[model samples]
Target: MNTIPEIATRLASLCNEFKFVEAYIELYADNAVSIDPNNKNEPITGLHNLIEYEKRFLSNVEIHDIKVSEAIFAGSYFSLVFSMNFTVIGQGSKMVEEICVYKVENGKIVSQQFFIG
Candidate 1:
């Protein structure tokens, strides 16, 4: 986890396996920040807050499939494309593709930003 590639690979692996909370707990810093489009582009600070936010979103959607692309690294940052097929509770199923960028510091993920496509 000392390198961007290592952290990115582990993050992608956990996400691909649908172990999102686990990945966050294992790889993110305590004060990690997450910027999500769905949240009106406001940054969610702290790992605990991010996990709670994730749980709320997960509870509303039923995941059918997920695909994570290989990570592309630049310095301490890395990016990956994630495609997901899911149905929102009470809504119809749909596909979403997003480019996820992450910043790592001292072997822990410090920030993550998502660009939905």
Candidate 2:
């Protein structure tokens, strides 16, 4: 993708299509850092850890539907909002929403942070 909005669109498409792992592999830099909702929680550092974290998250998810909306791009930053309708292990139908932002450089995401709801 040539523009930040394009990149954000691509990422949103990937996640909505249940290709979350592929999105991470293609969009993130080698040393990308990912933070969970709370600052108190240690951020997942490095590409490998990021991939593993995504895999773990997806493995437990049984996607009924997913919607990605509100992608915003400004300079070297982008934000995407998502709502996932799914089921997790030991849980029934549930809806989870997360607001994610990325610090992007040279077309690859350098750092990402998530706020869960």
Scored by TM-score, the top model is 1
Residue 56's lDDT within candidate 2 is 84
lDDT of 1 by residue, 1-117 (tens): 667788888999999999999999999999999999999999999999999999999999999999999998888899999999999999999999999999999999999999999
Estimate the overall C-alpha local distance difference test score of candidate 2.
0.85
Q: Model 2: residues >4 Å from true position, as ranges? A: 38-40
Candidate 2 lDDT, tens digit per residue, 5-92? 7778888888888998898888888999988864455788989988988888778878899999968877799988888888888878
- The reply for model 1, stretches above 4 Å from the true place, is none
Q: For all the candidates, what are their Cα RMSDs to the real structure? A: 0.7, 1.8
Task: Name the candidate that leads on lDDT.
Answer: 1
